[model samples]
Target: MGIEAGVAGAVLGRVGASERVVACTAAARAAGVRRGQRRRDAQRLCPELVVAERDLDAEGRAFETVAAAVAELTPRVEVVRPGVCAIPARGAARFHGGEEALRITVQDAVVEAGYDCGVGIADGLFAAELAARNGGGGLIVPEEGSAEFLARFPLSVLAGAVPDWDSLADLLVRLGVGTLGEFAALPADDVAGRFGAPGVLAHRLARGREPRDVAPRAAPPDLTVVRAFDPPAARSDEVVFAAKALADTLHEGLAAEGLTCVRLGVEVEFADGGVSERLWRHEGLLSSQAVAERVRWQLSGWRPAFTGDGTEAEEAVWGGVTALLLVPDQVVPDTGVQRALWGRDGDGARGELPERVARAADRVQAMLGHGSLTRPHLTGGRGPGERVLRVPVGDMPLETRPEGPWPGALPAPAPSVVPPEPRPVAVRAADGSPVTVSARCVPSAPPAVVVMPDGSGHRVISWTGPWPAHERWWDPESSRRLARFQVLTPQGAHLLTLEQGSWLLEASYE
Candidate 1:
């Protein structure tokens, strides 16, 4: 369904090497090299192969680029993977003049982005993916031809479809069935009884009898509003402002419709050709303020470059932020009885509070950064310290914190003063004796400190022995031993140690 530019080969190409040597390398169709295949072996298989180291970041950006381009044709773009995207054609076809024109436009845009891709449009995601793989380049499966087109493919394509592939394939081969057309002709009940649920599903799929509906195009709420930037704006602050305006408009529209929004979808187009979408859901109807807050929160998490203050800078920034769309995913109708009881009072009061909270949270996140705003989540682990972890504001539930604090464990809410790269300090004894740290030293024994040339000093007011920590002992090359010590000093308290007998400051409490 997509072209994987042999990421490894692409990565290898960045380095100086013979293109011929790289091309000769035989890799899996997706650029996945076979097990035990050496670089030389790959070079031998594809003589003109250009080996370039995979740039995952760039590829990620590229995927976004392609997704945005596709979005021009249809708003509903589901990214199948980093290199593949799927769009339901029924609605897009009507919007883009026709199915044929839509297909050509999508293909041309993708190709212009320097990627070779196979585009498949079918009744469903699975069928489309399969069609793309088989059609190669640009393939369209007509609605009526879905069944026939799928029939000719081998059962091998559906081997992993359901049940276990190996067992089903072995059984089918024993019975002389190979292609999907042959498989579909068999009685469904007979195959199901023999192979179980997967066989039944596979049979149905091969016959183009989809059990589920194609991705449905939900009718957007009547209150939905969208804003497109002529030159996409890339600044987070600017985007947030735009989102605020849009949210206000949406809220007003919803009020006029006598409804309240419970869920919203935010889609943004980036200047460097990237598209990002986030879905936000609230337990109850949200006010205009709440919606704006969510938009600001979402934009703050994105890292967009800023341009200096000037007309040119404004133009440049706007060019990057191509579009912003806010759709109400869910809404609740205002019951006549409830609307009569509180009238406008309930409406005005309820909405403003959530909006205020959202704005506060957004501001806090903007100041602290994304991961810094976290909530305690419990996780599966043995110790209390290991049981609980912090997660982003809107992520999966946290595992439970371990129960009951352990004796002599590190203090709660561990000191927040630790530096990223702890500076090493020389510890000295009260008598200014240099307690020579070595592999054989005991951690319980006090060691005096000495100041390094770097001018940082901590005297070992009290000392502990150098405890040996052997890690990765099974790995001959990676094995390492570290000595830990708890040292106290008038300057500060610290956990100092020697690693492989070399003095290092592992941690410090300042």
Candidate 2:
């Protein structure tokens, strides 16, 4: 039952800024080596702990075999994480006769690939993860018993559910809610009022159901560029160089539009009616260097042989690659693209990095045959965020100023930080009850402690206005009545607004 047999006496740790254990053999954990502890601390805790750096590329490449194995067993396989995969239980169970049978089949397939494996089945992923961690070869919690089964577990068991879970778990335990059952018993409304969105989410999870609505993404516009290789490429280097040039040109166009491409498609069409195309995705903006690297990687993995002349590049290559196309599948605004304040000479003597970036963005716009990048600028509106307007850079010829004046708008000193999305927060009264604003713009009680969105307990040094703004009073769908307040903590002053019985951190004043 133990997974530690392979690395019985050896301990492996993933090293980052400072070595922190990500995975370690059972013997190491048993010896007190723990995750999140610094390398020095881990060594002190377990003298035999072995440290090594985590190579993400290596891990991902190795997991491809696991993906292939699972793919053969079922058409639907989703990588939950790099090392873990999830197969829809219903189809697999039906195909294998039953849930237990499906688990055995999967384990057998993975085992045949020379790896030890465990399987767990439960009502949801949360429970299933717990079931897997219990060290059973196959653990299944009947649907009817999922909630009851989870109730006995102490608050500490939810450590992996979210970041800062340990502290949050301990906080709940000290609040006299030591077990999942006790925590789940509290009303959802009360939990939300006392905590925030994360709290509400955990409450639902404890109840055995986690609702999720993943929206479908919109299609990306075509930003494809193609190059023809005449007389066919005689050498691999010739085709690879052409691919890099095409990729670089495509990316340069994107950069000009104050944008970056995340996924680029590289396609090759042979003269003999053969084609090869693959999309490459990156975690960050693909620079010219990055695009070139991808070109190299793709070339290294592909060997073009025109159907039957021969498998050798010289024989079956069929007049080499006739065409190389680079397509940007996904484009997003470059958030980090900023104007340089210093000179190009490294001392801000006199520089035009901003101009350079803008020209590149413009070239991208021309290449895409459309509008330039749109940036958000402020106009006039009741809400601080509502005032911001997204204006295409090419449209700067038009005036952006408001006609006259905003009568009820708050004076100068605009908020320094305004979150694109409001964050859930809790404002409490001096009596320890949750503070709220009424429909008539009245305080339920004097506000005291303010629980920031991060779950940190900050003491209210002093506070200001429940400035009420009622918008779209005509239509119920679009109408909203909010009372905005200014709260000051040691961190800084923040604007808190209450809408429909919920508090949100809208902006901050530095």
Candidate 3:
């Protein structure tokens, strides 16, 4: 699903406690991988599976245009989450002549915005959502038909719309309350008593009545900040870097005004004059980092543009990121904000050094292209060298998670310096023969001398290990099997690895 051939992929949670699979492509599911399975189990089910971390921020950014297009149909649209929003059907329907007409209007608007979307109309939010899920040109329930529409669906449909739906559904199905219709038939008092407010609320949805208020929120103030890109951005990294500074400035302005944002908006105007925007929400206050991340994520999801409706071979030559805008869509009192936790400056007290560093890095990137300069982060891996990755600064990683515990991983008193390239070295055993390591990780003999590639030799004074490491054993072509050792000499201790038939010095301890 990622930049690879079809028929492979998986995604898992980023938090260590929840490393279970979060998503999997159809190809992976067909191979027996599924969401909720552990990393090892998913891999065991399909060794070729590609694992990634969830990118909710990016998804939010991409959904902005669709949300804005929906807004054009009616001024009041409430975003429940990325990929879904709720609009008041009554006013829009009256304005457009009817519900069916409104549906077509929405579909057209979304398509024009360059996204395919589904529009669902019914009595309430839950039923409308179900209608959307029915797919195929979007679904429109007849006036007063939400009850009938919900009736046909199984109890499992309650999962997202209703809190604690799973446990209640399981218990209900056992008692023969299998369908939404049957659940709706239950006494409201009985449901409230048995399952509490959530159950009673689910009962309301089952009956086609809105369980919660669905009125459109008031339009947010136009605290939008837009920056024009002179040459437009071709690659994502530079735009993403610039996004960080913009988000920081925008949020700082909001903070000075004593406001905390609930729903935020991001808009990008492309070099070709094409435009896109989406609204994003946060449970608590969103930080500058989060804002920048969402913008970057949104940029990655954008597709390449073409011209002349498939007749012309030319692409939009003037296309790149021409401008970026950040807006605070819904704000709250700054009461919950804890300024002290953020240190001296509200935006992480970034200080001069980081700002200077960012400017220098950006300059270098502008010269060498986006990814030429990378900032290293310690992540998951099996060995010293594998433990970190260099990612373009201010850009988001696709995986977004560190993968490891890497059992038998080299313990750290990490080397003071790791050479950019490993240098080949020769080792001799006590008996004077060239040292070697067996497949079982047994050293040919105890180390006696270390010979540099330059022909300088030093007798070994102390040493440890033959710690073995292996990864992706299923893929023969790419699998790695190596044994590492730490050997000491008068100069200093070095981390060395043995593979194939030669030894290489990988790092040096201070």
- Of models 1 and 2, which has the larger lDDT? 2
TM-score of predicted model 1?
0.39
Tens-digit lDDT track of model 1 for 1-510: 122543334233211112112121223333433322334555555444455445434444456667666766677765544456777688888988887788788888887877666677787655776766554465788887777887887665663244345566778889998888888888878877987766777778877777333455556456657888765665656666788788888878877878766557777777667666755555355555556655554444344334355333322333367788888865666453222121123222221323455567678888998676666554433223344466765455543432322233334334335444545666555576545555555442356664643786645577554555565579989986656566666776665556654566555665
Listed in order, each prediction's TM-score against the native is 0.39, 0.43, 0.44
Compare candidates 2 and 3 on lDDT and give the better one: 3
Quantify all predictions' global Cα lDDT against the true fold.
Answer: 0.58, 0.65, 0.73
Error of 2 at 440 (Å): 66
Using TM-score, give the best candidate's number. 3
| Between candidates 1 and 2, the TM-score winner | 2
Ranking by lDDT: 3, 2, 1
lDDT of 2 by residue, 171-224 (tens): 787798988778888998999898675577677667766433343556545678
Per-residue lDDT, model 2, residue 88, is 70
Across residues 1-510, which tens digit of lDDT does each residue of candidate 3 receive?
A: 232325577767643223666555546756876555678888998988778776676456566667767877786776666667888789889999998899989989998987655688887777887686465567888778888888877776665456545567778888988888999988888999998866887888888887645557566466787777777777666777778888878777777877778778788888766765666666456677777777765664464444457553222223688888888877766775333311123322221224567788889999999999776656677667776667786675555334655766888788888877888998998778998888787888999999977899988999999898787889999998888899999988998888778899988899
Q: Residue 149 lDDT in model 2?
A: 70
Worst 10 residues of 1 by lDDT: 15-24
Which residue pairs in candidate 2 have backbone atoms (N, alpha carbon, C) closer than 3 angstroms, thus clashing? 253-364, 256-360, 256-361, 257-361, 342-348, 343-348
Best by lDDT: 3
